[model samples]
Target: MSNDAPVSTTHAPQAGTHEVILEMRGITKEFPGVKALSDVDMTVRRGEIHAICGENGAGKSTLMKVLSGVHPTGSYSGEILWNGESAHFSTIRDSEHAGIVIIHQELALIPEMSIAENIFLGNEQTHRGAIDWVLTQRKAAELLERVGLSEDPMTKVKDIGVGKQQLVEIAKALSKDVKLLILDEPTAALNESDSQHLLQIMDGLRRRGVTCIMISHKLNEIEQISDAITIIRDGRSIETLRVREDGVDENRIIRGMVGRDLESRFPDHTPEIGEVFFEVRNWRVQHPVRADRLVVKNSSFFVRRGEIVGFAGLMGAGRTELMRSIFGRSYGNVLGGQIIKDGKELHLKHVRDAIDAGLAYVTEDRKSLGLNLLDDIKRTTVSAKLSRITDGLVVNEAEEFRYAEMYRKDLRTKTPTVEEGVAKLSGGNQQKVVLAKWLFTEPDLLILDEPTRGIDVGAKFEIYGIIQRLASQGKGVIVVSSELPELLGLSDRIYTIFEGTITGCLDKDEADQESLMRLMTNTTTRPETPAAS
Candidate 1:
């Protein structure tokens, strides 16, 4: 069988007397001013992989929270039936005790702790009120093996890559003796190979009779691994399709989740290329801790006016470091580099200097660096450029409100009002707010790292439209993304980075997945585009 084909031998779910292991009846979840889910009904057969499909705010995560006790009992109106018995869970521990464990898109592992410690965190191996060290290590090793991870149990979680950390989370779940495994957007941060491995592990779990429920926006993956798919549209359960060898396709899933046919995943726009407006020469950055060793080698690239240039590379390929070092020394110490804007060499010594020079960077980590969850929308919108709403010595609150309202409407940020705290908004809306924050800066150049990461397809299209609009306004755009298809679809020109160096550059017509991957891995004969400035 092909690698893309399903590993399951049985195309259908349990045929005979298998019981329904889980039933969520009349589930309605509500937040402050939003009704997330409405009277949703879902059932999962024993030992089958079930998938939930929806748009960004369609309440897939909220429904999973309700089931896993993140919402707890008395929080949402719902009836959870497990093994034909009504189950009321008041905490995550209650759900775990019942053999249901969930791994969210954001990993929950403590970074400083070792794999063994993280695995047996809450449920330690004990004897007569004393922890058993040998037993703990042995069991942690076994669970890690089950998840196809080769790392030592003594290794810390922070030292591992996200793909390996994903496996560690599964090992942690295995330590709980999970009978039902729930994964939310598990492969969003993973590459194609890592994603394939994760899918294989899910299939392995199904063969061992573990019921799995997955929520994902990747329609192809849903069509492949799932035995049944439940489509949620605007907080309503639309329909469930039972998978057969030839019964399902990507278009069907897209149409169901989006409530209409999405003919293209990206908005159409033609590039109006102009002279190179942004250029970096001989960029070299030293590692933050090990100053002797360089993290970004002699790299050079350029972006033209009204162009979307893409940086394609693997994890830790120095893309983020390069961008950060260029933007006001937010990262490592720059050993040598010249940043040129228009026709002038820029000497940006700090973040303030970079911002004043009309440069803005939207970091890849939105939670930690992009948005302040505690601040209100109005404040966040005017944060980067307070001068716009400030008087000579005092601040004008009405002007701030008006400015925030205008950008909120322009970006189509979905919130109750500009007074709504950013902590209450969804992932897509939070991303929009971040963009609004940078747009207020009136930047001539915008740097976006993983712009659409962890968002839904509909939200991705909206963001693409925003990028195209920005380009239309003659602002230079640089996009760094791990998703090759995203880079291929959006970029007017693409540069591949490997081991902190520029390996190859391809124009839009010459770039594809194979060429990009070859250059990314340094498999090309020589860089098609010159690296020397």
Candidate 2:
């Protein structure tokens, strides 16, 4: 089928009356024990940047899946109207043929392939059944430029970063002559500048008559760019707001999604800072892939026994690399560093050494690094300290289950049972499981990397409480977060990193969002007076 050709069964929303480009009426989707979407109704106008927002499991992604044909037409009860007519798409290709393209949160580009090859993968230009390499590269360059990407088209996808990869995905959609674009969390992993660039690109596309639907948790971005905002909660549409209308408040949008006014996004806490317990000195790390390049440069910091230390920086600022390298050299090549626990120097040559040294690093990407998805909660809980449940090489299942159940209640993890697979739990619950795993290890120093990322407001509050509780128990906690408000709200001490160097340090009393942002952006000048003085 021609990529640009409209599907025979696809109907476009009527052209006149502002052109309803897409309509989903009476959409109902059900899974075992879960009604994901219930008689959902949605309408999209032509060339508008429509934002679909909700808490996790709020049917935002499910509705997009239904539209993109990830859930085939027969699987859900719905009528899809496009360009003023009815449409039934049995497959993604069928929808794409009708100029509908979706870019999922998890990208689908082949890492080994070049950007040009990935963009024109399925619909490559061919002459006499042979791929037209020259034409393909030229067209790919044009598409890349359209998406504000200046990378060489021939560069392998693996060599580029996530922001560029997202742009490449957009370029691939443009190559398919996409008229309706659905982006699921396009800027979730992107830094502020990259996210802003992506939003600008979306605006550019809208001006070019491409209708866009974006799913995002970032309310600020939505408020800034969306022409319309639709809030869905519990598989139902709560309300839709026109940004151009008078008195459109962010609180109203949040209340619609959450069913309550979130007076504060962060929970209140009083940090009880104790004596210094964990300290890193003269820390340095080389890039894992490029051994010659230094990623973390002489980073030195300390967390007190009953304090939460916040690490703030832009993406690739070496925050995560510093934590990981100090944890056990789990990330980059350790060039030089000294970690001291209670005035005793410890060797962290390996992960086991770090663990034995009472150090635990909870990864930012928990799905791939922190938890074993296929394993049960009990198994995951004891994975970090199998020896605790082991009796002469034999694992004590009862002991493991008992510890898991205790932690489940302690952490307030919302799981049906400890026997349930960690994969079946919500993002917040999965994070709890990861925390439980490390807590079981009885670590003195805890490194939490984006511990509350992708969780709901309620879950975030609970997590904040947990962090405070950990500090209260004399555990030194270090948190790395992209959200500056989170760092300012939860931290006793804040350290700002910029381009692999620690640029500024501030106590909770002095670290406001604006000041932190200044330090994080590396715009603040160093004071002549000593910080201690």
Candidate 3:
């Protein structure tokens, strides 16, 4: 089977006759003007992997938060029955004490801490008044082995990759003797190989009689691994289906989540190609911290007006570094390169220069590098081009609101008002706001890095439509995505990168998963393209 294929759980027992380990009755959680979750019900059988499926703003995360005591007992109206006993958790500690541990989407491990320290961070193995270092390392090693992680317990967390960090989190849960494990979008950011390994680990946990509640947008993975899936929509409990008995598939899950059948995963788009308007020649970038390490080698690519160009590469293959370096040198140091747009050479030394030169880049890490969580939607939307709304050092709030509201309506962002904080918005809505921020810049060339990383299927279709609309308007778009199917479905032309080099360029007609993988891994010889000259 392919690495991206979902792992099979044929060895696991069916959940048909399993005992009920947890039950949440009428979980109604509200935040200010939004009823995040309303009358949401969920039941998890002992030793079963139960999945929660929903759209971005459908309150999947909110329901998990309530269950894990992040919202506390009094913050919401709910009855949680654990092993047939009523339970009230006023804090995260209370939940953990009850063996209900939740690993959030954003990992909580400190980068500077060692693996052992991170495992027993809060629940340290103490010797009288001090921490027992020997005992901590010894127990952490045992837990790591249980999760199939070969890393030493004393190794620093910063030295490991995201895949390894995730294993550490599971080891930490095992340290707590957790009975119920809740994972929220755990594999959302993981690559195909890492995701498969994590799924296997979950299956392993299930075998040891560990009950898991997973919230995910990946329907294929959910269908393969989960014994039962509960669908939530519009802040309400829709229905729960037994995976095998009900014959639930991705289509059925999509119907439950979106309230409609999406006839297609991508919006139909026909490219109106023109002469190449943007070109990069001999572009080379060095690592930001390591001057001797070249992250992006001598690479070149081009984009034509009214065209959507896709970039395909393995993780750490310099796809992002190449785009970022071109977009105002936001990432690595430029060793050498020349950017040509419309037959004119341009020099961009900073982010402002890139924006002013009609270039916009939407970063992959939206929460950290793109949007300011503390700011309101109106401010975030107009932030990239505040000069347009500013007059003589004074800002025009009306203009800000007008632009924000316009994009919000155009993008179909789900929000009560543009005045709401971006932190309150869902992943898809947050991504739309990021796109709006760049669109406000009125850039000629837009570089999107992983535009739909953690968004749901319905939202992905909408985002694809937005990209096509931009291309239809005679704009040049460069899309960098890890999902090859996305590139295949949306792009007119595709470029493959391997180890910081542009390995090959293939037109839409010649590109496929197999051919792209060949070029991406540098398995075949380089192809001559206009950029290669």
Candidate 4:
């Protein structure tokens, strides 16, 4: 937040010191009516971790696909030079043959397979046309050690945490003798500790003379680990900066990615928080499967008529389970609890009862629980309010289309038509559709779970604006997000949850990343600050 301007480091890197490992020039890709990338250019040093920076739908993934041959040689117009030789990769296998490996944002490991099995799934060790299990386990152990992991090769992939699985992926790449590694948002789903460990592994790879290319939205990590940074905007290369000498400024990088200076990432909204209109008191619930375990124990929280409340917790802290249980007992059996809305106590037996009781829940997994991807936009938008758009004995199609059109334009969803399938829309637009679906229900309270997860910065700001607008209209909003900065930026008041219980609650003026994380991990106990005025 300093007033100083970002330093300029747009010139190319010094050539005499570090050699160029890969280069792409005049890369252009088009899909249907969209021009994804237009004559983009990129360069990477031999042993440096180069970071690709851009907002969502900025062609970052597309450009990487072109380099890795996912788009194939003839599919796109680009010339790639690998170690001073032309690279005409026709398939992913071709790039792998050249020692190039790409780990996508979504992990590709099978859950049922063991660590060693996933590492050498397709490229396995063999002797005389037979699979060699012993050698495979030994080699997997070696790869795991190289990545600073001590996991058992026999352990199933599903048994490990997401952070450990990421290391397993790196071990898989090492098995291929990878020279150049491309990781696309590798730490997006990982927690703070896991992210730090992943970065350390990347540093280890760099020491071994491996060239690394990382695509990430976390500016702090990019600033910390990247030796060179390339900024892409609107399907074009803006500039590249040497993080050490160049301004290495966060504001400068953000401006380049957004095409303009954003004075504040979160929109300025002073909420007029009214009286406590919705309250959950003494709520206790048992684990969905393990009846002996209590997931939510003696948890009590309240939301005002016009307020944005945030729940801060680490992974598996029972934040999502608590909210899901309240929204129609979705996750666990409610042993004893009271949901009082406007002084009326009610019991919600099913999701329909929750929706009918003026409550709407937008799940974290938009693709799975929020919307039916194969269904068109119109059907998804009016799904929660079918009774409002239905006739005596049938669904009124025209009424549904009209409602969908109103929300499509209101939320600014980027779709050719309301008839378009939800699957075809980008992550951001699909999220907007999910929001629109709930908005039509006109609920008194909205529980948004990880609303901005896996989305771009621009889209995140838009969603923030929607949340602000919703609160401004006297609707109680509760948000659950993994990103602490997001909770700090958007929440008027934050409730820190730990082990399925409310550990501490802090007002906006007193909340910080350190304090929130401390409460989330149960490091500090006493947080009794009054709510902000």
Compared with the true structure, what per-residue lDDT tens digits does model 4 show for residues 198-249? 7777776777788899998878778878888999987899999988878587
Better of 2 and 3 by lDDT: 3
- Candidate 3 structure quality by residue, lDDT tens digits, 211-239: 89998877878988999999999999999
Q: What stretches of model 4 exceed 4 Å from their correct place?
A: 1-17, 107-120, 123-176, 285-294, 332-336, 393-395, 523-533
Tell me, by TM-score, which candidate is best: 3
**Considering TM-score, which of the candidate structures 1 and 4 is the better prediction for this target?**
1
Residue 428 displacement (Å), model 3: 2.6
How do the residues 73-94 of candidate 1 rate in per-residue lDDT, one tens digit apiece? 9998979999889999999999
TM-score per candidate, chains pooled: 0.90, 0.86, 0.91, 0.84
Q: How do the residues 411-487 of candidate 2 rate in per-residue lDDT, one tens digit apiece?
A: 77766589888876655567889988998998888899988765656567777888888888888899988777778
- Kindly state the number of residue pairs that clash in model 3: 0
Ranking by TM-score: 3, 1, 2, 4
lDDT of 3 at 417: 93
- Which residue pairs of candidate 3 clash? none
Error of 2 at 41 (Å): 1.8
Tell me the spans in candidate 3 whose CA falls farther than 4 Å from its real position: 1-6, 9-11, 14-17, 109-120, 124-175, 523-525
lDDT of 4 at 503: 92
- Looking at model 4, the pairs that clash are none
Worst 10 residues of 3 by lDDT: 1-10
- The per-residue C-alpha lDDT of model 3 at residue 432 equals 90
